[model samples]
Target: MALKGSFERYGAVAVASHWLSAALILALIPLGFLMQDATGETRLIFYRIHVLVGVVAGMLTLFRLLWWAAFDHRPAPLAASRAQHMIARITHVGLYAVLIALVVSGVAMTAKSNLGAGLVSGDVALISPSPIRVPPRLAHGVAARLLLALLVLHLAGALYHHWMKRDETLSRMLPRTR
Candidate 1:
C-alpha cells in the first residue's frame, strides 16, 4: 500500500501514526491527572513518562503533517456532502492545530514549573527554571482543555460517519478487509 493512502484504506504510515498517537494520548491523560497528586520522586517519574510520550506524539504529529502536505491523501470519502467536506477539512485542520498547541503549551507549562519537575532532560532548557509562571501555565492549561473539547467533537463526528452514514471513516484507518 502507498504510504499516504490507497484508494480506500489508510496507508501504513497514517495507520501507524494514528494508532501510536491514540495510545500515547491515552497514557498522557491519566498521567496528567495523576501528576496533580503525586509528589517527590514519583511525580518526577510520571512527569518523565508523560513528557516522553508527549514528545513522541509531537514529533509524529509534525511528520504526519509534512507527509500530508507533501503527499496528500483522500481517504475514500464518506458522503461527499458539502457539510461533510467542510467538516473533514475543518476538523482535520483543528486536529493539527490542537496537537501543535498542546505540545507548545505543555512545554510552556513545564518551564513555568516551580518544583523540581524535570520532564525534559537536555543541556539546554526550553523554558528554564523560574517561578511558577502562572500566565503560561494558565494559558497552556486553557489550550489543552480546548484541545480536549475538539478531540471529543472529532470523535463524535467519526462515529456519526460510521453509524449513521455507514462510510469508510474508520475503515480508512483500519487494516483492509477486502
Candidate 2:
C-alpha cells in the first residue's frame, strides 16, 4: 500500500497513524477511570501506563498532523452541501483540538504531581505522596469525557455515510487497493 495519501483515499501511513492514535486514546480512557478508584501498587502501575500512553499519543498526534498537512490531498466533498462540508471540517478540527488538549493537560498534571522522575526511576514508592487536585488534572478528566462523546459522534457519522448513504466515505480511510 502507498505510504502517502491521495485525493481519493488515505494511504498506509495515514491509516496506521490514525488507528494507532485511536487505539491508544481508547485504552487510556479506561485506564484513567480505573486509576481513579485504584490504590497502592495497582494505582501506581495504572498511573505509569496512563502517562506513558499519553506521551506516545501526543507524539503520534503531532506527527499525524504534520504528515497530513504535508502529504494529504483533499478529496472531493462527500457532503451534499457547503453546510455539511463545514460541519465535517469543524468536527474533524474539534477532535484534533480536544486530543491535543488532553495530551497537554495530562503532561501538566504529571508535572504538578512531580511524578516524572520517580516514574522513570522505577520507584513506585514515589508514585504519589497523596492525590492532590490540580486544575490541569481536572481539565484532563473533562477532556477525556468530551473525547468519548466526540468519538461516538465520529463513529456514528462514518456509519451514516456507509450504511445510510452508502458512499465511499468510510472506505476512504480504510486500507484498500487503488
Each candidate's clash count: 0, 0
| Candidate 1 worst ten-residue window by lDDT | 122-131
Q: Model 1 residue 30 lDDT?
A: 73
- Put down candidate 1 lDDT per residue, 131-159, tens digits, no spaces: 23666667656766776777788889888
lDDT for each of the candidates? 0.72, 0.81
Error of 2 at 40 (Å): 1.1
lDDT of 1 at 88: 72
Q: How far is candidate 1 from the true structure (C-alpha RMSD, Å)?
A: 4.1
By TM-score, who's the top model here? 2
Please name the candidate that would achieve the greatest lDDT relative to the true structure.
2
